[model samples]
Target chain A: MVIDQIHDLQQVYRKVVHSMSRPGSISNLNNITEKLEDDLPCNHAFFLCALTVLDAEVTFHVVASEEKKARLIEILSSYNMSRIAPVDEADFILLLQDAPEYQMNQALLECKTGNLHDPQQSATWIIESGLLSNISALSLSGPGINGTQQLQTGIQQDFWQRRNDKVKEYPLGIDLVFADFSSQIACIPRTTAVTITEVV
Target chain B: MIAKPHFAFFDEGSKKEIRRATLKAVAIPGYQVPFASREMPIARGWGTGGLQLTLSLIGRNDVLKVIDQGADESVNAVSIKKLVQHTTGVSVTEKTQEADIIQSRHRIPEKALKEDQILVLQVPNPEPLRKVDAREYMTKRMHAEDDYSGAWLLLFEQIMKFGRMSTGASHPVYVNGRYVMTPSPIPRFDNPKMHQSKGLILLGAGREKKIFAVPPYTSVESLAFDDYPFTVESFEGKACKLCGSTDVFLDEIIDPDTGERTHQCNDTSYCMEQLNSEEKVEVENSYV
Candidate 1:
């Protein structure tokens, strides 16, 4: 069973990398049941998404509750996880669909960015939301942008507002990505401008 | 060769971006140049930093040498060498002299590198004030503004208690009298090599996604207070058990059976080179 979990974890990681490089794309993970979807506490799946490798030095976070933290600690330890975080110190922020329940503020304060040691090493926020469109609609512009490209994600207004609050820090802010539960992702680097309009 | 992007390892378009940044790094000398970096084949902490720079600067005819702690045999060095060879079919070497570009992890070679030589250092963490100070935005502003009193105060505190600024590896230095820079984790002994040496010095951090440079013949002053001037650590009483050299960096390995520790040069190739040159040393091993 542990072997199966480990193997699935590996597949999830490759998917994340492929999507990031291609941008405006979706990665479908075949392993792991959909039943375990909501049960995933933090972005452990999201963490596993971009994580080609996990060591004692990289960090992760869980701010929802202490019980959640304890459970995460158990799961991460079983995977030989290193550099686990208090949500505040995480390099990557994974927001489950049900997140922002009671602890979003604490998670926000804990994730304030800056440190010349690694300016770009600042935390990245990834939220899993239901897709609202086929993605011929949204447009994104920023540093990674070659020009306006149709960005696709089904995230709502308030979701982006939460991201903007973090984004206002300018060069010192966190980058955001909204991925469908389908694994289709649109990245809004701190420099990216997101404008949602309906396709005529 | 590890089939790379459309043009060379990094696409011509990507190379253009890096080349523009390299120009800024050269123009500004020591300033950290922010770049839109891409993911490379190698892992970050290893030599990804230097690998990125090498990939960007790689031309068809260039000769490259990669060293970790001054030895080419180190696994990380071997891995990076393989990657560069894969992307660009340029000749790679173990010796520091024969190469046009050298990507080094720690120790600077004992031989003086030429002005034509380009040395790239792999940086794990580039900020010197990170552990002691808070705020990355402020640090960049301070570096741009040349506000270094805060860094000095921290060193002063260290001296008051420990009698020396206790930074080992990643030792901070003012590069070209312009920007405060971390010479990656190279030993302080190699710090002098950065001062107006023949080679252009570039630092890269793949995970952090930053690349900065110190131009040839530039001033790089390691931060130090007047009363407690900066000093480089030495092997002191220790000598390499293999080469019997006292001046080299020694790695201490504890013997499990006797609980005794044996010291040897952290540089495997350097030790072997010493044995080969001196008639006094002979063993069944490859040191011949």
Candidate 2:
């Protein structure tokens, strides 16, 4: 089920760019996952995002459970021979939906928040969510956003708060991508201010 | 014999690398993301950065527009347009409305860009603090610490030396209210068009090997003191000699025979369009 690397990667990269630029906008990356192995612990869209972003030059750290990490590394290595570094040193971090809140917080704190002069060197988090759209939502407002936008994600309030804390320093912080089961994606860059609105 | 150029002139790997960097740039507005800028037929300091961006993002269906100093026929612009056309065989257009991707050096199009259009600006030096601090690491530290006193100090000195701010081109702007970015070397007159622009603006510096962006609907305010206020290059009563259009930014032209100076619209294509339109139809074009 291997897809066309050059063309598929280009198409996926465009969708990812669209999502990242306009925070909270849903971009469909459906067919990008057509090539992933069937039995992987996580959805294929996340892997599609990984391959589109991470390459031989950039190292990635898998923050999921031990089983998922092993499988994730195996699949990722097939795409590139880049070594997996520790969470703090990794250029990209892949977190599964099942990853504990403590692990999420640890990754948030330990991941490289690039220094002011080289903020572009900061880590980007690609988090997997259970569903694409839900009743509960997260409010986002920042640079790319017109005013404010709201999108549904499976992430908890505590996680959003932790993310906010990490980004208080302005330019030196991690950017995030949320990929869901339906192959829909959303982003929250470090410059964005995020709030998990409670579902009433 | 010279070898034939590859599609878009760069290898697939290079294009992929650029696309990745571009996505990261858009994700984090105004923050300069370093990329492995490839050597093009053009020199580094010219429009190579914008060229790389245009090459990478260009699909077979894209209609490209290239401009230098507001003229599509400028040497730099023509060279780039020919290079891309030769490599990708993509249709090139002078009409701003027809272009999907517009690459330019030092000027934004006179017509307002739509949300679907992408603008790639060629930047000589991406660092706005280069004048204030020579060391890259020191400036990085300053930006990290949210310390931009040096930037303000530089502006203050300009005000002290002259009666008012004298920055004509390459004016510094605060993007998304986060990072102070140089909107390339575009005249201050074009700076206002970038504020919450409908189109996405990507700035690339080939020599510097950096890329950054101002996404659609984002705020881009030029750096100015509360008392001084941000001002664009003014052309109050001046009108283009050819089209008699008074609103657009005008370029001064010397009359060799009469030893006099007259003005013409800096944007050649827009000027041509104006001259072609019989009546001086005035809707107060939103661009100004």
Which candidate wins on TM-score? 2
Per-residue lDDT over B1-288 for candidate 1, one digit per residue giving the tens place of the 0 to 100 score: 854444246644455455445533553446576776777777667777688788776655778888888788888888888877876777997666788878888777766777467788888887776765678787777774567887778788888888788877767898745567888998887787787575667788777767887755567899887777777877788888887998877778899999998898776667777878774534544464
Candidate 2 yields a Cα-based lDDT of: 0.84
Strongest candidate by DockQ: 2
Docking class of 2: medium
Alpha-carbon deviation at A31 in model 2, angstroms: 5.0
For model 2, the stretches where C-alpha displacement exceeds 4 angstroms are A31-41, A100-102, A133-136, B1-6, B276-288
iRMS of every model, one decimal? 14.1, 2.1
What DockQ does each listed candidate score? 0.01, 0.53
Chain A TM-score for candidate 2 is 0.93
Error of 2 at B224 (Å): 2.0
